[model samples]
Target: MKGRLFAPRLVLLHLVFLAAVVASGWLGWWQWERAHEAGGSFQNLGYALQWPLFGGFALFLWYQVVRMVNGTELHRQGESITVPSATGHSESAGEDATERTTGGARRRSPVPPPAPPVTEEEDPELAEYNRYLAELNAAARSR
Candidate 1:
């Protein structure tokens, strides 16, 4: 079983990115508010940029988290994933599709042999249950 905090490397990277974004936003907001008191236009630009920056960071972080949750091979064990700097999105998308298809195709169990039918006398409890079920079904259909 996985530990409570045993997040994969990709997930941890996303968390760290999220933390940096939050910290940067907080710092920017503090500086902006302070500069606004002193009447600086640069702080206005910084403040204006803050939301978009934070939003982009959040989107990237979300992508990483989704990849981790969906079992994308972002990293293996202690090694960092060697994703191509360009077109990484396509690679990840292909991996996601492949994983989903392969996962579904994996068989959980083999077909079992058919069981012999039991007579009413062989299992009184089963007979009673069947009678009760039939009664319930009849009442439902009547309703």
Candidate 2:
């Protein structure tokens, strides 16, 4: 399978994401109204905005997940995942890509050596441990 998104699993996943988005949005709306109806303090107002923003983020995440699963990349603008850098400028995904590319191909990590064959001589410690554990279990059962 080429992993296309017209399958049963994708349908189930879409349902889950949709439910999450709806639930978060409702919670956010409830919080906002609660703040308004209550004392109307700065803290309450901040909570109101924060909850709505969380709801918005959940919705956006759902959209992105669906798009990616359906063989499409996320189309975003000014979405810089900022790392705290000494320089004021932030690095981007594209910049990382360019930095890592060597010639026309990405560098391949060196393959590790094949593992040695198993031997029975190395297992005496495990056998002793098992015997100790069996002794403890037997003692506990007798008690």
Candidate 3:
């Protein structure tokens, strides 16, 4: 029974799949015949046969795509979630871990507070230079 999904497109898909298979099989046969007649290297024979196998693979892929579009095939689908870090777990798992460690306390950022800015006065020469610069800036602004 034809479903509403891709009913029109199936004809085109079938044509393309048929073309691919036919071409691949022809190539494989040509390669095999060439190898048999002129003492061609085994490589040609291998490649020739590989063409037909490639065609078959194309057909297989098309079938898979159709099945997937119809919601019939489910393979290799995985569950992945965006995470801030490379801890190999999801946010819920991280929450559980935090609760385990903190005895069910609400989760909070573990980052430390920013350090206090260093004072130029620590170096007398630097402090003097900074004062001079500040005076220059003040004069410039006044002008």
Candidate 4:
């Protein structure tokens, strides 16, 4: 069976989650001690709350780690995300549409024209960069 996976972004989020868990645990520990110093009992009911809350946070973090290891996609952008394409199906049609509608693979433009013309006079800096790139390309090709 074919399966789609978001490998890189998921791994990044897992790392973030791991860091958050460590930070939360350390803060929780620090807070617990601070509470103890303020005449709070560490072995009492008040102290019991800290362990469960911290432990729950740790468990939640661990669950995310497990999901990441199992190749689950993590959506950090607050949107309903689809599985990333493992196959090149979208590379053919989607890329062309993206190029036409959004301009190139980067989507730098908010809305791209169907066919945009290059004008050196309009943007001299970009034109210069383009010329530099062309020179680099020509030199690379000659090698």
**All predictions: root-mean-square deviation over Cα?**
16.1, 14.5, 13.8, 11.7
By lDDT, who's the top model here? 3
* Two-way lDDT contest, 3 vs 4, winner: 3
Of 2 and 3, the candidate ranking higher by lDDT: 3
Write out the backbone clash pairs for model 4: none
> What is the alpha-carbon lDDT for the whole of candidate 3?
0.65
Model 1 TM-score on a 0 to 1 scale: 0.35
Compute the lDDT for candidate 2: 0.59
Rank by lDDT, highest first.
Answer: 3, 2, 1, 4
Top TM-score model: 3
Model 1 lDDT per residue over 27-131, tens place: 677766766775767757667567557757777867766666554332222222333324345233222222222434322124433344556998989878877
For residues 1-143, what per-residue lDDT tens digits would candidate 2 score against the true structure?
A: 22455578877876876777777677767767777785566676677677667767767877787667643322122233434333467654343332234344332235533334334486777667766877999999999
lDDT for each residue of candidate 4 in 27-106, tens digit (9 for 90 to 100)? 66766776667566655445545655775776687686666554432222122323334343333323433333232222
TM agreement with the true structure for every prediction: 0.35, 0.40, 0.45, 0.32
Worst lDDT window (10 residues) for model 2? 71-80
Residue pairs with backbone overlap in model 3: none
**What TM-score does structure 2 among the candidates reach?**
0.40
Local distance difference test scores for all models: 0.57, 0.59, 0.65, 0.54
